[model samples]
Target: MRARYGCVCFAVPKKLIQHLADRSGDEGHKQMLQAQITQSAAMRGTRASKTVAGVATNAGAKPLQRSVFDAAGQTFLPGKLLRDEDDPAGRDKDANEAYDNLGIALQFFSSVMGRNSVDNKGMRVDASVHYGFHFANAMWTGEQMVVGDGDGRAVKNLSGSLGILAHEFCHGVSQHLVPGGLGVVQVAGMPPALKGEAGALNESFSDVFASMIKQWHAGQDVKAADWLLGEDIFTPREGRAVRSLKEPGNTKLTWREDDQIRDYRQYKATDDAHRGSGIPNYAFYTAAAELEGKSWETLGQVWLKGFDQLRARSTFLDAAHATLNVAATLHGKGSGTHNAVKAGWKKVNVLA
Candidate 1:
């Protein structure tokens, strides 16, 4: 079958990696990081016109089927199968983390959202861990998920980061949720890419849902939640998390090189998807924090359902409106959740 879309959703932003590479004093380490960026681009191009296997939502399959594989320090995807959903946890720490985290995400989405796996129709979730040599990224490549063992010093074991895993998984969800792929743009001679405001929505939705999953799994409310993405993936020396919904551009809460912007006023058409997502990330945070309860409840559902109606070329304002409509529909027009949703967009200056 043709690719559902060619856009690859990566956990680590290219800009951040570039920043790290640029600042690295060791030429060898810098070259290693730069090579990753090159390989990632090549991977995207490889998948530009074709889909990878292992993402079919067959009928009568397990309600939530999953499998884990070991990339064994290679770029090959979904490499040697290490464990299946029915198998016991393997000794490989990265493989086990991938399997367990995927299960957690499946449970949350299934039990709470009533969605069956990534495709919402029992599509199997396949993951590959330990991808590449010191590769500091994770991604959903249209068909399956791939994770890398980050350089031990700066970016560490991405598979161990539940937020990172969940964030990438949500990319699959978005690919399946939004018809034609969320914010996917196809130029005459370019691979289908996620760009502009729609691209930001894609990244923001990943971050928002990842945050919701993190909070829900920890049994924490919005107030109690750390609201950090990829907290476990980074060392204290490099940074805390990848991004913070609590504060988009606040490097102290996230990392030193985070270029995310919370206000729409700061957005540019050329901003990377991760950086541009900050506006909506803060919008979701604003609404959820005000709701003062578990994020996956009404607010989270409203946000998810709102994105459900979006197309490939949606904008931040488009997303804000969709979520607002969902909130008003699920909760009464003037309900607290509805007001919160409205206020979230207005606060981000998207609605205003």
Candidate 2:
């Protein structure tokens, strides 16, 4: 029987208790137990019982929406996928495009490196499309990756290129790869924002991996790698390409104003321009380029290993150190891999 407050039914007769008390001299213990029962009853009498959100309802549960595609795996909220207006053939928005890109990204990770999934633990990948009306950007929101069909002028298709998807999915990979993992509570010694940098590294790694996939697929020399994410995704509305790997500020776009079309050229800066990624984006490209040959085969492995081994809230320096350690451990202290990683950071003034 359930206790009323702290009172439990004593099935034993009072004569049985008297016999036990005489044998054990436990009268004080019995009295204490009786007192506890009385106090518990007092507390319970003051308590209230009520139903909340129905007995079996989970109305407050945070649901995760998941979707799997050929290029990558993504989870996202409802009403995310949007149409791509920039397709010259007007076929980019086809759902199959998302499926195809997801396939490519997943295959690149598994087939290229012999890895299973982003976390290597097989966490479900999530993707969302048509985020926000005519949104101009795509992002991996830590939980799921979301893509936007650009304004038909700046960015045309969401799934036309594998690198773009890879970049976003890499965020998931990085979240799992970090030491403490994502959404961890802040410890006394660590800064919360530093933990967020793992997301950035995730994006950076995706770009690196995407470029590697392109090079591997094309069978191109590392030096000759195009490093461009979407070569054909941009429309004449934006005179320039989606983003340039070799040059940051030099991509030009053409916009129409008052029925008169004018070509505007821009370089990436701190301002809100896609071109601004040129600085750090190029740093990653430069690092990989400096370590030529099959990137996933060597340089990519180094970065992956480093990212996986470091803490969740790593800095650029932490990444540099991890890369250096991996290089020295795998190659040697002064090997070309070591020197190249060092030089790559030096070029960006990120390291000595």
Candidate 3:
């Protein structure tokens, strides 16, 4: 009961493959160029320089001083895994959860997608928890995915949920494929309205992949899904699960502005305050669920190829168009896979 990429290696878009051939002069060379392109494309829509309110940077700042690991082969949680106490105080429990979840996700990815690791290179996946002083967020800081205690309110432990860990780690995957080689393309340098949406799309890709990993572990059923974003991290009193996969803006977390927090609507990933990514997140879930079967198998590959073929500073429409090209390449111009992608974006009000 195993599937392989060889069983379904979507044809690289002819035009794209030809373009790679023309640019690199050989298939191997073209692949290298394409990998570089994919890495660069991931950072296209990120206006990451403005210093968004929740975002943090600093390679040496190990607030929790946690240990990390790389899950290469078959590894499972609740087994031979590290504990949060292996690091600084208060970080042990969460760190343990994060470490265990990373193994779960890695196994799900390899078993399903046939990818060796996030970079398909068996790169060690490092995670640090208890970042900053009560910092209420988690992020992939180019080098590692760090999590905070979430202000001890809405999110008590960022590492408490597998989905959250998977979400942050997926950012690493995005980094490896998209922004990995592009360096850093600031948001201010983007081409207008499409700015945040592109970044949001990147975030949504993480959510999609993370959800797929979770679903795959649960044996492919969303109905039995926890559906709570960072649920384990959030206190029961906080109410609401992690971000919704089918419906956005349907959380119980009520902040100052009900519209902002409770609504949980996904927004275009622009320089528009760095919140509201739920809309695009929901759209991604819709698309993946619509595809059915193993997520990494079909939907994930389509997205990987689509993102790989795009350029830095791409817009939502650009993403949609690139996906169309990839879907058509992977599943023929008139195939159901192509149509599914088109409908997925169209349903979300994003066009091809």
- Among these predicted structures, which one has the highest lDDT? 1
Can you write out model 2's per-residue Cα lDDT over 164-219, one digit (the tens) per residue? 66666665565556644422234444322212334334445555676677777777
Cα lDDT of all candidates, in order? Answer: 0.84, 0.49, 0.51
Candidate 2 lDDT trough over 10 residues, lowest sum: 1-10
Alpha carbon lDDT of residue 123, candidate 3? 54
Model 3 reaches what TM-score against the true structure?
0.63
Candidate 2 wrong stretches, greater than 4 Å: 1-93, 179-202, 237-239, 252-280
Question: 2 or 3, which is superior by TM-score?
Answer: 3
User: Residue 211's C-alpha lDDT in candidate 1?
Assistant: 88
Q: How close is candidate 2 to the true structure, as a TM-score?
A: 0.60
TM-score of each: 0.95, 0.60, 0.63
* Higher-scoring candidate on TM-score, 1 or 3: 1
Across residues 213-306, which tens digit of lDDT does each residue of candidate 1 receive? 8898999999899999988887777788889999998998888888899888878899888888999999999998878878898887898899
Q: RMSD in angstroms, all models?
A: 2.2, 23.9, 16.5
Cα deviation at 194, candidate 3, in Å, is 12
Best by TM-score: 1
